[model samples]
Target: MGTRLLFLVTAALANGVALAQTDVPAQLRVEETRASQLMPILHHLTDIYGPRLTGSPQLRQAQEWAAQQMRSWGLKNVELQPWEFGRPGWHNRLTEISVTAPFQAPVLARALPWTPSTNGLIVADAVILMPPGMPAAGRAPRRTADSIQAAKGGVAEPPMPKMNASPPLPTRAELLAYLESQKEKVRGAIVLVGPPAAPEPDFIPQPMRRTDAEWMALINAPPGIAPGSSTRPTVEDGRLTRDEINATIAEFLVKNGALARVKDGGERRGLIRVESTNGYGATPQVPGVTIANSDYGRIARVLQGGTRVEVRMNVQNELHPDGSTAYNVVADLPGTDKSDEIVMIGAHIDGWATASGAADDAVGAAVMMEAMRLLKTSGLKPRRTIRIALWGGEEQGVYGSQAYVARHFGSFEHPKPGFAKLSGYINLDHGTGRPRAATYFGPQSGAAIVAQKMASFRDWGFMGANTASFRPVSDSAAFYLAGLPSIGLYQDPFDYLSRLHHTNFDTYEEVYEPDVRIAAVEVAALAFALANDDKMLPRFDANDIPSRDPAAGPRARIRPPENHGEP
Candidate 1:
């Protein structure tokens, strides 16, 4: 009878301990995260600092500010870790593009980064420059029988004009020769490349979240469903690539004394999608701009009506000297017994210079900062140290994170002293949407561990865990390729892809406060849990670490220093 009573008592004590362990996350959810505490951090990153393009002065200033804030919060070992950028840093000072002829109107446009300034305002006539064999736009064509049958059968139609078949694009040599032939016409004109398509109307409402059915389908689907690496095609692509073609056209413009090159921005509803110049050097000789599709279409229509259109443009840009480098912001929250082991949370601090880059990465950097603050203020003593890295050069080629990993913790082919001591990394770079669940890239058992650890925050929309479809192409991919355990959060789409990404609309107003607050709290809880766990997150064997493309991975192409100026 005494033995039975003692057994019951022991079981109750064990159960009590388990309950306390689970309650820590619950306690954090209820007490630590507050909107007032979080929004100010985000405001400083976006509103005050604006876009932090890698190697730009704005990014350098922001990195210093972030490091100072981490130290003031009682975090230790804060530093601005530097890495070679290998090219001149460029930023836009002023860009003014307007349509003055046929009728006075303002055209929505922005200069491509790393492109040259026009030196001053220049007014010039416009000429249409289409690629060889690309058919000119005309009246709508009648639908073919195949199209009608495909529509009736609910099959997707082919992605081309209905009945207006066009010849194949010219070979590379042929394209160059054709451009040489048009030298006289392009010598002194602002070239408009290609006709613009009318924007299609979107009828469906914005999705709040993917349904369970949709997620399951995505999980079960074969690999390559989602996008892979976005590395541009090179000489090895076996044929003429669009990038090569564009580069050739730009070279032609430079040689032929063209005033500038303008194209449709390829976005809907007057939104302009911005991108950098393809050149690896400081800037190109001829300037380039992508205006709103609506504006481009209007100009094309006027030109088709034989009414000559003229444009006036004035652009200014600055480029840092050769051998300039960018930096990553690093800090640490020391632990109790397991201070040597590290758990990392990171987000990129750099973004495209289109807007303030609020959704692209400002929200992400804010989340990491707030997570550190939450853990510190809650007086939690984790077992492993929690580190935060605000990475730079992620927009260029994820250079900051890769450089840190290679320097501190070497890759699978080469291991450093700290390689084995690191536990795992959690990265948030998706957008301002709430983090719905955690996805890991490792053994199958790690999913169960993550699901168990995240049970406490189920109501905050973090309920489940799943294996990643493929390795991430963001900052996390660096760690993943290095054979370290890495985790990523799956969030709602929330205009990140359709409207905001790399566009002028990525301002502070696009951020939803409540959602990002939840994201910060979830990151804090997960980091703390991983820190105190008995064992680290499961990792794949060295042999199982998948190899990635050389072009798509960390190492970026370095241009010669001599090419850092106008020819």
Candidate 2:
């Protein structure tokens, strides 16, 4: 508040903005804005905090730690706003699985987050069930030739509805409609059985786009399951209309008589890591768990042959039912000139409890913390307020961000005021691959122009990286839905697709220090620039996509930003 202190603070903030732009003094560069000072904070977050599983104790600790750290660094209004929603909270505390049966192998996997848990002892031989391919009685065994031929676009038989089953599963349309409703019939106990495969093995299926109808057409028409061992079956999740397939699967389940068909493992088979923030569009399994993929495949093979395999898994995950409420962490560092106007950066602090959720976002939470620290400590006073959110329940269809946006901006019940004043929301939830680039995701014409402006201070060439855009998947989507300008920061990944993304392997060692430092700096600098920029980012073209009319229920929204694919 003194003249000297004010001058010093002004000078330091000016320097932060300048150093990011032009070549600066060695002393300041080496001392004030270097990456090394940021490491300890990152270490504390990723290492000490470990994995901040959503709604778990760790997530709460990290949230409090972040708020305290930010406030200590001189941020005001650093309060954790409790988010109230239908399903504000869900978690899996302890999951112990022992394969007790013929040829028993200790299961090496965790159930997905928000999945029900088991407490009873139930055992059965592991079943390897394949996808709904042709009835093995009429089909050949799986082979490389079969895989290869199935990869091509030639079906042998017309599709036929799955028969000889219990009852019909939820229809595709039914599933889509259900997805909108944020509700589920969480029963007594549910065991997470996924595809049984080598742990986190790296593999990619041939890229093939097939919708539910297309897949059914492939199945019933000619030779649906790979003919002999010549062709391969492929599914490109990105390009396919998964909702349709999910509905079909649901319908099949309902039509078929089964309690729940769980998979055994991850990746190779249909089993995916429950902790992973990523998800297949529609809920793959409702009444059942996505059991071990390997187990399912094995069971399918036996069934295909002349062997009948009956396996049962006793599952028990009891919830308090009375005690379940999730919360989101919302803290702020007000600006001097434009304190009410906002510049928000968010990352889901909560995680799946596989292996301390190190990569999925432990790195992200740390980076956001570091970015806030940089802004707070550096004595930077921009024109807009800087807000950070450590969202809870994001893994369960982005409930945290959705709740906050609805509460502050607008929601299903009523639209809130102050929409026009919100400058932008910046979110960083991708793992610790380093902030490679910022996606420019708004409208095409306007997005191009805004992207150029951000390129000015993002010394990492992030503007060209294409992460600053309107991808309706992460927390950013929540803000975008309100018609405010926003962006999501992205970093490079180490085994993101195969190992880390959301499995136990997402530990501390996997995060690249240099990459995180670079990311932290990029995000901080961009926050500064966006806060200081004279204009707001552009909006998506009205004609680009149809708006959500609330005709169906609210479901998880995800989008692969334009022009990003495997290298």
Output the lDDT of residue 473, model 1: 64
Candidate with top TM-score is 1
lDDT of 1 by residue, 439-464 (tens): 67776677678778777666666657
**Whole-model lDDT values for every prediction:** 0.75, 0.52
Q: Candidate 2: global Cα-lDDT?
A: 0.52
Q: For this target, which candidate reaches the highest lDDT against the unseen true structure?
A: 1
Error of 1 at 254 (Å): 1.3
